[model samples]
Target: MNTSKQRPVRVAIIGLGWWGQKMVSILKSCGTELEIVCAVEPNPAAGDFCANNGLTLAASYDAALARADVDAVILATPHSLHPEQIDRGAAARKHIFCEKPLALTKADAERAVRLCREAGLVLGMGHERRFEPPIVDILQKASGGHLGRILQIEANFSHDKFMTLNKSNWRLDPQEAPVAGMTATGIHLTDLSVKLLGAAYDVRVSCETLASDFRQGDTFSAHVRFKGGGTAYVSATLVTPFVSRFAVFGTKGWIDVRDKAHVEAPAGWIITRASVGSLIEISEVGPAEPVRENLVAFARAVRDGRPYEISGEDLVNNIALLEAIIRSAASGEVVAVG
Candidate 1:
């Protein structure tokens, strides 16, 4: 939370696509702590959206970066553009909050982190699942040794939301999206795995086009081995009805969480737990606006020099695992993560 003494973080949103527009709506609902001063979208049709939202529509990303009033920039741009945009933001001396799958490659992710660190700028991520109440509870239990000797995790995040997208959309492009549903959905699972089980040592993945026209494939399943002696199975399918689940297994106890709706439209979560000498327990966690929580934390970091939840090392490690997932899917062999 930000103190009233601190001024709002004026931001220029770098895209006006579905997720970008969604960010605008979330920030508006977040009150005056985070202000959208401008927006950069190539599509001229977004002019009306900017006008209605009381935002200045910049002609280009460079124009937005050059704005003196813009204290930070939130990137909802394509995956390939993240590294360069982060570099530019650091050069402009503005704080940055980038959408997930920060970069498609490990080197680019590392470079983005380095540039931001060198410039003493806050680099925030779009992994909102970390802020979810249920996930936070799980993390606390695991770290407190209540779960005891973590063994494995299984997670799946799938939805048919992208099925209506045009075939030529960048999200469906092989060069842009790469492996199946990994970029759009599976990456979030992997990020959660890293947060719970530390870095991955290797991964084996299979990507197949089951029902969608996406050239890269509509589904992918990844088997990851963690360096800290645990395993994780993370998967996603673009053609499936909405499904989000995560289970953590440990020596003492295990927990299973099932979401009734997407994070953007949270309904509730069913959590089941079991322990060595106790009866299985089931509880329900109410809905939460994690996306707004994540963005507000980023704003607070920029305004008060507070630390963001995801560390730079964690950011790079997740991208490293993502790179391995892509390679394993391509070669039909297990790939090692560095």
Candidate 2:
């Protein structure tokens, strides 16, 4: 087992929307050490979620941040709103675990990381794919020289429908959705791509405007070139029926995760690796509770004061790469991503 043992983290979730509510549900089951102390949400669904779970619901993040009871804050608000919330949480001396992209722009993402650093707080971005037990096991196999020399990976995440019109939230807006479904979700693929493939160098992307109702970019695809002569050509389509999932390919084998559909569409996962004698296929079904692993990882990171499997720098760089994809899609050119 890992040597890090942290006391249960005192957690608060801001913007308890669809995903945010799930975060709370998973954290709730995380034993007595972990706790959901407060919630900051404008929507009634969030309030209901907290009430049903017996969690304290705060009317605003400002109030939640001021409270001494909250030890950490999870920013599940919106893409454009992430940076400021993280900044506020850091200033309030709370550890932060944000959903994705970090922010709508690279500068904003950079500032979020910088602010978190200044506060000496552990900043975790929710790229929960890294926590998938099978995925973790696969990465270990590769590092153990079972894959010989790694080559390429293809990761994809798609979404077509959203249950947002009822809520009157920012996600339905183009500014919040940003570069379509990719920024909202596919950054997981890019972040995973970086971990498996090495530093992504140049990104060439293409996005189609599939939704007439949506104001900004809707459907997006990108090809990221990794420095080690590997590639992660990732895509996110809002027109598709599936939700979040990931796939990785190495020289000796390939692994695919089919996230069980939950409106979130995680389904299950399948792993295939090549051995000296034959091919091996291994699969693991997801939990009735999916977000528990993510919260536990964060709580452990906070308690241990060590590096997590995921980080803010990775989120910023992934957002930077996503931003490059948007630029490339707009300009029809290859964008160099640092």
Root-mean-square deviation per candidate: 1.9, 3.5
**Separate clash counts for every candidate:** 0, 11
- Candidate 1 matches the true fold with a TM-score of 0.97
Q: What tens-digit string does per-residue lDDT give for candidate 1 at 1-338? A: 22233578889999999899999999998786798889999988899998888888998999988888888999999999998999889998989999998999899999999998988888999999888888888889999999999999999999999899988788888888988889998888899899888999999999999786789999989999999899999999999899999999999999999998988788989999999999999999998999999999998888878889999999999999999998999998999997
lDDT of candidate model 1 versus the reference: 0.90
Please name the candidate that would achieve the greatest lDDT relative to the true structure.
Answer: 1
Relative to the unseen true structure, what is the C-alpha lDDT of residue 315 in candidate 1, on a scale of 0 to 100? 92
Per-residue lDDT of model 2, residues 15-118, tens digit only: 77778877776676799547888888886666666678898888788998888767888888888778778877887888888887777677888888888778
Could you tell me every candidate's TM-score relative to the true structure? Answer: 0.97, 0.87
Q: Candidate 2: what lDDT?
A: 0.72
Pairs clashing within candidate 1: none
